[model samples]
Target: MLHRLVEPAHKQQHQFILDRLVGVWLTLGEFMGDGDYGDVIADRRVGVRVEISEGQDRYVCPACEKPMILASHRIQNRTKERFYFKHLFDDGSCSGVAGLGEKAIAALRFGQTKESVEHQRFKFRLLESLELDPSFTNTMAERRWVDEDGVKWRQPDVQAHCNGQRIAFEAQLSTTFLHVIVERMVFYRRNGGRLLWLFRDLDVSHFRLAEEDIFYSNNRNAFRVTEKTVELSRAGKHFVLECVWHVPTLTRGGVSDKLAHGIVRFDQLTFDVSRGGVPRTYFYDYEGARLQAEHRLAERAQTERDQELRQAFENFYLPFLNGELNSDQVETEWPELLSRFRSRGLGLPAWPDNPKGPFHYLLAAYSARAGVPIGTDHEDLVKLAHYLVDKRKHTLWIFRLMLEAYDQKEVMRRYDTTGRWLSKVKQYRDAFRRGDSHYMPNRGFDDLLCFLFPEISDKLVQAPGTFLGSART
Candidate 1:
């Protein structure tokens, strides 16, 4: 009796399940018996899957074309699992509705319809446009195409051949599942065909998620067909579409995108087949422009950061140089300034004694590089250079090296117009050559000098052995 009951139950199984979204049907028994069917049911891959809730009307019965609900039940002591589809409203309208359960009202929803009037009109418009274009040939509407494996097929709204390439145009007027879009793209790509998703209209000011799904996935390009485009195609005697895309722009804040659109002939668009994981179509190179904008934004940001850092350093150092802040006070505030530099991946050398700190050395170097006074009341870099050589003999060699290394030969020549500074420099050079400790190189500030002026770092007399080196190490 038990064997007879099992045989009868298996004989009453539903024949097939239909996915209305992608317009694909699958044999129920064959899909259920396949080992990989679990992945399909889980919606983990890009293929046909019954993704309907208990009351939702996504999948339907193949025989009656009525909404179907998935039913699951356990059998035996081992908790064996089995799943099947039954009519949501079983009113004796179909044979597959028997022994399922009580019926419920099917919810009317958008995207549940097979095709809308707008979608059909858009399809016909594309068909007409393709027929008008001399570059396209063998154009057909609602043509079915089989993949290489012959296991899957897609009936594109309009199909055509362009320059020895198969082109399938899908008119999208409503929201489509991402998997549906990806599956169509994969199918067309595998069959050596290109799929172009067309929109009836697109509002750049506001973008629906579905529109973005198509726009962003196609290299930030979205094409639309309307009366204007169709008229243009008729006038130009070629296929035309209003192509909308994002134009990368560099702004004060950062890189931004500006919406741009224009009516373009089909030949103006690029048919890119080398790219993978995206629709092989675009009107402009948005990705390339975005990368260039990002690079320029980075350069602008770095320039701004350098300006802010220079201003802050001058603000802090000027006051101390004029004796408004003592060594202890400068030391107290040094760490905070150092923290800011550290945040920008720059390391400052340790604070030296007040009279011999980096303040004067940096001021002289900056003034010389600018060809004008930066911190002090000196009229020109010549005066600053003279002052450093006369009063700060300990910094003479490094300052002289900076002047020469930084390409300030004119300033040096102007400083020695009367030969006074030059004579003094020669005396200091002679003393240094005679191993005079008074004119020895300041090795302690090598790291700080390098950090402040990286151009002359290679010309420093000694190898860096300070905080900059230690931090990098």
Candidate 2:
């Protein structure tokens, strides 16, 4: 199941890891300095080095080369944690047979704990802590506590009796599935035991660590109180796990309020509230981080697009600014347009408010109304009437120029790109909706959209460049 989800890049990385593990395994055996004489050291020789036992180092399957975990098992009546290489996959072709079964491997990978050195250390530290506690002197590591049918319930990293309560302290470092955690919790609680899950610090990308609630605020919130956990440990208090509030910033390629990790007591966990009465499930909190990254990427792309548009706008209008352009030839071919916008009153807002001003706005609005790219057709009438209802702006005398434009679509583009010219004028909206072909009835409509008189000049601002594409940039 884990292998199925591995992306191409991750698969390559996993292959590299597998190769390294295999290399280490191939070099660990020392049988008369000859590779063929590989032999397994008996459990009686605790510190001996052999093909199977490589001192205190990690091991991998001799056949598949998948990394293995060193765990405890009773051997010759002595139980101790030892270097035991296990296969990661259930490949029958592999001659090695000492690793965990396929189901166990699947559970371990789901919990994101495959070949985790940090997880191993945390387990050892928890055991040591419990051993030092007077109330938990009966604490033991890797104890096979069984169920009524002699079936194995759970082999916690460290199990102890604290204050007359059986506790299972788990240093959860991997992305364990929710069902697994819930199952273990229910199993422990039913058999007179309580489960406490602990997490490492905010190392978000450790085996895709950030995708879990170990650092999230909602649902499966886990506090990251590394210092507090240590302080409490020193004071011999009941261990408290940490929780964090992972706040995502969705702005111009940056985030705000990023410090969202903290500590929480065991009782504060939601699972404890209903542990015995019913089962509770939790989810991963990594979506916040994923969304933030996506937003930042989108903002960056938009910025790049704006820059491109600005460059194109400059190139197109540079000839006019340098007096190298002449619309006389164009005017002759499209006489109606030249006559309609010939007057300054009929034009869009001028610079320095807008660089290309009326001319650019006219082209962009026409292009948008036609659903065509800019400069595609110079003679098509701007569509205005079709979009008047959506643009929700009052009719303008400039709209009368629809004799040379599409009345419906052009009207919508003008209203959208033009500033809130008729936002406060209720009668203008009513008049336009009724399809009145008369003069704009409201005074604000004429003042805001048609005239540049001093009384309403203060309200006028540069409209958006929605239709102009890069020209507005």
Candidate 3:
């Protein structure tokens, strides 16, 4: 019972040191239901936490299967912050407490240093193309540029000055982390320089995630430098690039863009730095084209809706006019048509006690404007015109204006051999002027007439005296 326990104390001290070592090694964690372990360092570099706040995404230690949380640290006087995963509860049951041995760290460093031959060749070719252009000056390969604050710096693959403007070009050959790309863009923008990301080729059918990120962000445009482009540059004695862009087109589904590419000179491209100091360089105006395409699609949709409404009205009104439906049936169905018209911002008066009188009057006015019978039993436009002037005297003002607005006087003259229709119109005009006639204007029926025949809307707003003065002399 009094035996000394010296071994336990020594083992506890060793475990404490191992815990610290494992803490440094735990940079990755697995999100619940996700097979891959998300890299916290990359997330921190981009200032976006994949797991976000606590409990947002259930993350666990990749090796120990214990609950984990994202942890961050910033050393004094350093601009960059470090991020890693830490165990929620540190019970010393996990074998990862021993840390990742030295051999594994060495392999990681070796793999990062081994750059692909293709990437190196692309860098050299881009440098060569810049040198061939006389417009470019002070062009260098792998130059380190310091920001204005002197707290940040970036070493672009190729840098140059053209037209007193600084431009940096980077060749994307393989998978590059989003953080690295974003950081470079921010640094260049703040330093008053333009950054252009170049690629070797693009497979639009099988676009990589990285390619999509670049393509969509830069006005749906991507640039490439291929062997053919370099040869053209050499022959033309200037800088050239193969530009790939999306041309917006209206499709049956919606507005879509098709892929288009061409060889363009450096000077031929638009270099705009107006939008929030972010540089936009492209051969085509993708934004403008897309906006125009969207506007066209909206107009087409509106036209189609107007035609559909016109057809529905014709179907209901023609049957009632042809004696296929009785007045009771029309009264019951008139409310439904009113509801449809209201949906399109067209308001009509409620169903009256005698709907046929007003309905027939409106049908006569529409038939006159259209130069054909629409919902009336009249055999021709002249007959409908005579009925409107003789029976619907209260609506005679708008009916005359509609005739002049739609150029229906010729049809009236062609049929009225005795000048009866013209004489009736003049007699009504003289009586209305003398204020001794039943030429009252019904505002409700006028609105209904305008809705049925929109061509006379402008003329309906004019004063009766003003409209008649401008009428055919």
Candidate 4:
């Protein structure tokens, strides 16, 4: 059955333990790493094992060339594991055995870049596509540096020169390792080096997706929802946003897909401070609501402004964009002006009237330049439909705007339902859950909010022929 409501988390300590089990949902409290046989490689052969320090069953020692069978048994109830079920093999299971419930961690050749393209080459291409030129090439990736203070570390990222200062880069993958990378960069900067994180394909392991739905019975089209949390604002409460985006590093989900040739791959914050010039993010303690509301407002306002900017491209700004407005012609012949019908068949939302907003100015200019007077005619609308439907790539500005708008719509819906009571909360709360973790009240939000937060359509974007998988977007 589907979960109807959520309750609070039982223990905050579990969150710390939970972060280590990077991939997949975990109600099981165990630190799982991918490898086998005690990180040992003998005669160039790799051995794998599964060891659970805590749980019903403990460790398993398999015989060489064959899965081991139990040769003895014991039970210990006072251990971390609630169940003391034991399997012993005195005959041959282990050459050496230690630790309770020990098993080899699974091994996955998870996030290797394509063999044909090196990471540096791909990054150079990406920078070139972005029109960025590096002034120097002192990359920090795997480079050892010893500062004047005897501090030493290796940079596993990029270091470039830009605009007369050194630029440091940490091309981070979307995993818990990101925290380590960012920490190193932070340390580097503290010791006097100009560095900026050149964020790569940020979305990787998020469980989210976007899909459009058509309601034939109601003669309406709607977007379907899922278990994804789309943050309307990039400035607040978004530490996990990068995790989903960084999932490109995690491949090998199944037996066939793990080794499949050329498998598909893919894939912010803010706040304020009471006094410091440095930014201080106000989290969920007391000031979270204010920060949340403010950022949302900023995003909403920004989206509207972006739409206006798009309009301006077709109107007054088109000449500037195309380098033609200043070319001449103080006053063109009336016939010539009348004959131009470039954007005659386009439609869009009405230009906003908030003159104080920069959006208004941007829209006024662009739409006018293209002769698409903001949905002035059926032809204009048809032109717009064609542009949106037939276009291959989506506009980031437009995408951000739409996302912001959708977020506002959801916010409005939730805001109105604030005081309402959920009938199934108690019933669902009473339901039993597996594991040693206790129940908390916030998982209640998890139950209901999970529905509100739909999955992303796409996750990380990887190079062609890469085995890394992307998000569903």
Candidate 1 lDDT tens digits, 1-473: 13211111244457556555544344554334444435434542223223433344446775567776545554675234456656766786587533543221111212332344455667777888887789899998877898898888998888999999898988666555666777888889889998888875667555556667888877888898878888889888989999989999988778888989898878777766434546567888888888899999888888778778867776776675545777688878878788888887766656723445565666666665666666577766667766776777666655655566566666666655676766665676666667677656577767667756666777665522221211100
Whichever of 2 and 3 has more lDDT, that candidate is 3
As for TM-score, the candidate ahead, 1 or 3, is 3
lDDT of 4 by residue, 1-473 (tens): 32122122232212111111222112212222333222212210122123222231212321121222111121243211121112333453444222322122111101221111234553444333223222334443435555647866544444544445554443322122323433554555555564333223322122112100101111111111111222211222221222211101121231111111111111122223333222222112123333555566666775565455434434543343344544343134222322332233222222222233223323322332233424223244223323332331122122222223244323323332432212221222232122112222112222211221222212102111122111100
| C-alpha lDDT values of all predictions | 0.66, 0.42, 0.64, 0.28
Clash tally, candidates in order: 0, 29, 0, 79
Per-residue alpha-carbon lDDT of model 3 for 295-397, expressed as tens digits? Answer: 9999899878877886777677767665688878888888888898898887655763255446655665556567777766787777776776678766667
Model 4: how far is 70 from its true place, Å? 21
The lDDT ranking, best first, is 1, 3, 2, 4
Q: For candidate 4, which ten residues in a row score worst on lDDT?
A: 210-219
Tens digits of per-residue lDDT for model 2 on 274-317? 32354332232444465767778776886575455434444434
Segments of candidate 3 deviating more than 4 angstroms:
1-117, 132-134, 231-238, 267-281, 285-288, 321-323, 352-361, 369-380, 387-414, 420-473
Best by lDDT: 1
Q: After superposition, how far is residue 91 of candidate 3 from its true place, in Å?
A: 36
Model 2 — TM-score against the truth?
0.35
